[model samples]
Target: MEPTGKTVVVVGATGPQGRAVTRHLLGSGWEVRALTRDPEGAPAKELASAGARMEDVASLLAAANGAYGMFSVQPTVGSPGTAPDFSAEDEVRWGINVAEAARAAGVEHFVFTSVAGVERHGSEVLPRNLVSKWA
Candidate 1:
């Protein structure tokens, strides 16, 4: 597809799902602004090389201010070395913050990618990470 001249903000753009979404969006010709904790990291650098604009989460809303869409994908809870410090409540809060920011920015499209079990079961039956996604 030709460049649509539209922009999409991709949160967690350093992670697997976020990277995929970023690549797809860029391939489809939408200007991609990737939000990440570390803009100097390798993954983020790769995205920038591929024509994405990298922005930190703190400044995401400003970068997405006039964007046409937003793709939100957060880190998984219990991820290998990072699980010990992960907080489900914090994850949920961050998700809410991103959504609210996107809405306030008047993004025409919002895509939130949740875990697999979230849609299949209630919160009580899911793990903390999944429950956070459900919330």
Candidate 2:
């Protein structure tokens, strides 16, 4: 694919899946805008060195004009040594926030990463309680 002049905003760029996707998009010649909480973090710095436009989430949304695609992937609340304050509600909120932001920004293609079956119930009142909130 000819990604030249086409920007792809990758969310969670510091994470595993987001990093892989960002790398692939960059390799395909896309103008990559990697969004992260900490722009000075190792992963964001690495992507910046690789020619990506590393920006915080707010700036990323504002600069998404003419963007061809967006990849949203928020990490689940569960994992080894995760903060005890984190909850399933936070995950659902993150997913919804990303989708709404992308839509409001008019991104041409919004690629939402969620668990397979969980997506069907995203709007349900109990989305956060599902086994896989990504759905």
After superposing candidate 1, which stretches have Cα over 4 Å from the reference? Answer: 80-83, 119-128
Per-residue lDDT for 33 in model 2? 83
Clashes of each: 0, 3
Q: For candidate 2, lDDT tens digit of each residue in 1-135?
A: 665888888988778888899989888889988887678878789989887888777775575666778998876766422466767777777777877777878899999875566555545554443544644
Error of 2 at 93 (Å): 1.1
Best by TM-score: 1
Each candidate's root-mean-square deviation in Å? 2.1, 4.4
Candidate 1 residue-wise lDDT, 1-135, digit = tens: 899999999999888899999999999989999998778988889999999998977896797699999999877677532457888876777788899989889999999987764678877888765767666
Q: By summed lDDT, which 10 consecutive residues of candidate 1 come out lowest?
A: 74-83
Score candidate 1 by TM-score against the native: 0.87
Deviation (Å) of 47 in candidate 2: 1.0
C-alpha lDDT (0 to 100) for residue 55 of candidate 1:
90
